[model samples]
Target: MCAASAFVGYSYYENQLLADTTTHLLEHYNSNYVIQNLQGTVVNTWVSWNLIQGQTLHVSIVNDANLPEDKITAIKDAILSNGTITVDDSLLHEGPQGTSSTRYKGWEGALANLQSLPTKFYIPQSFAISEGSNGAGDVVITLTNDENPDGLSGYTKSISDGNQILKSKITIYQSSQLSAMQLGAITRHEFGHALGLAHSTDPSDLMHATIRTDYPYISGCDIDAIKGLYSGDERSQVMCQ
Candidate 1:
């Protein structure tokens, strides 16, 4: 009788532990932005902010000190139109020692990267470019020689109104050192962040945490992520009306 009683007690203890573990898992799953397939299986995870369609956003360019106006214009042109800007590497002025390179990416390259995404959003000449101005822009692309000890290429900051993006700021570091292709890649990546995309685990993806030096571009998974974000499905937290 004592042996049977001990077996029943052990079973009860195991069941309690299983119940606790399940509860914890459910809480964790519920708190994050989880991506699932039609089969009701989790595929990936990331957080995003929705951008309402037909809302125009203005982007301003703030150049580094002593930078030429034409150089700033090149960046501005790239962001405004899906066109290429011929970069004369020989004409680029020198920057800090061991911190500058002759390569620069064109604006079309970045636009191409964004265009590759299978999203329904359009990029008209909605963004405006500017020089040093006190007025605030919906999105600011600041070029700076800030201390980049970690060798980061670019960074982006954004504000969202719980459901949609209100504004965003993209900072490009060592802009002179980057080749046109690299600049385009970085721009595309930062723009993805501004559009409420999180990093992808795949190294080849444009939204990966680390930008690949070799012509890194967007992937089908990245496209699917954006489509899912705007799909208005149950997995999405923000939906467009």
Candidate 2:
């Protein structure tokens, strides 16, 4: 009788432990973004440049409209704030090939000294202004005066194969109306997209579909989301803490 009682007690303890472990795992899995496959199995889905390329993302800046020097500088500064920027005028511009307009030339001369920038935040990634052919894994930023019917200030389109992002194109529209500060905010937001971040539900967050924040810089929540993304958390939309 005692042997049977001991056996029952041990079985109860083992079952309870397993139950607790399963609950913990479920909680963790549900917290991240997941999708159901055709086979009826849940799977994680996330896209990131780091998954294919290394920590450094090469960038090519093409000023098609010849936005003022300060505006161009603002764009570079915004990128530098997140990571280091190496200016190389020699990099062949990417995207929209065969334009003979000399006005579409890439920015010449070095970017303004980083120390002059008012603020600098650090992330794991870096950017290089490089010359390369189209679809060569470069983030091409183009400044243009084209007006969008949707009235968007900027737009980012990323090309990906599977979970890896091959390249990205960021176009800034209506450059004449935006001030330097406004241009910087828009650049930061689009750059986030280039890094594989989706829109955030928070209006105050930089990743919002429409930027309305007075202090439109990258926040801690944005950093946390990036860390989660690179770590394989597939969240449909970022939620602020």
Candidate 3:
């Protein structure tokens, strides 16, 4: 009887410790992730595919812009790559150091402490290109020479139900003027939006508002932000710093 009572007490203590740790980690995440709106209201605007829809994001390329085979392939490849998210441990450690800013030492430290916490988080998704859009996919990419009213090279619009994304459309403008490499970069940036990523504060990152980076590939910060979004955390934007 005494042994059983001791065991029960230990269990309660362990559970409480876990809860406290999780709370701290969440606080840390919010400090770095959450944003405030113009009305001074805390808004967590990040949205992404729910578990069901994200299992497989079927994509259909309309190719209406009549891009060449190479450009078409580049666009397809870019979509596929961004769909696969892999967090870089190096990046987690590269951010601002010291615990003065937060209780945790750094992103790596926070993630390490969070590893034991049980939470519903996003898993990496797979992307498949459906042939001719035989009603197989919810994402549509249209390549067109039609210039955007905003004069942007690419644009993406996503429809979401609540915080869950339902479908997305990507429009690439002035495709004729873009080289295959340029098309690939633009496709990557737009596809990031289709996958529910907001623009990064870092201009050097691929998800920036403008595609000016010489290497317009997905960055570690982008992956980390997506992971946070799919985890159901509402963050308006994510920054590498």
Each candidate's number of clashing pairs is 6, 3, 1
**Which regions of candidate 1 deviate over 4 angstroms?**
1-53, 69-74, 81-126, 218-220, 233-241
Q: What's the lDDT of the predicted structure labeled candidate 3?
A: 0.61
Question: Which RMSD does model 3 reach against the true structure?
Answer: 23.6
Q: Return the top candidate by lDDT.
A: 3
**Which has the higher lDDT value, candidate number 1 or candidate number 3?**
3
lDDT of 3 by residue, 1-241 (tens): 9999999999999999977854432222110112233444544566676655336567898876777788887777676542333334334344444411122111222233334444355433566785463433667887788967656677776666666666777777767767676777777777767767778777656777765554466665776776677566777365786
Across residues 41-149, which tens digit of lDDT does each residue of candidate 1 receive?
A: 5444333444454345566667664456565654554455443333232333223344422222332333345543444444321445666655377767777767456
Worst 10 residues of 3 by lDDT: 26-35
Estimate the TM-score of every prediction. Answer: 0.53, 0.61, 0.64
Give the TM-score comparing model 2 with the true structure, all chains together.
0.61
RMSD of 1: 20.0
lDDT of 2 by residue, 1-241 (tens): 9999999999999999977854432222110112233444543455675433235667887777777788877888777743333322222231235432111011111112222332212223556764333534468887788976665677876666666666678878767656777777778778777766778877756678777654456654566576666566765356775
Ranking by TM-score: 3, 2, 1
Clash-forming residue pairs, model 2? 91-130, 91-131, 92-131
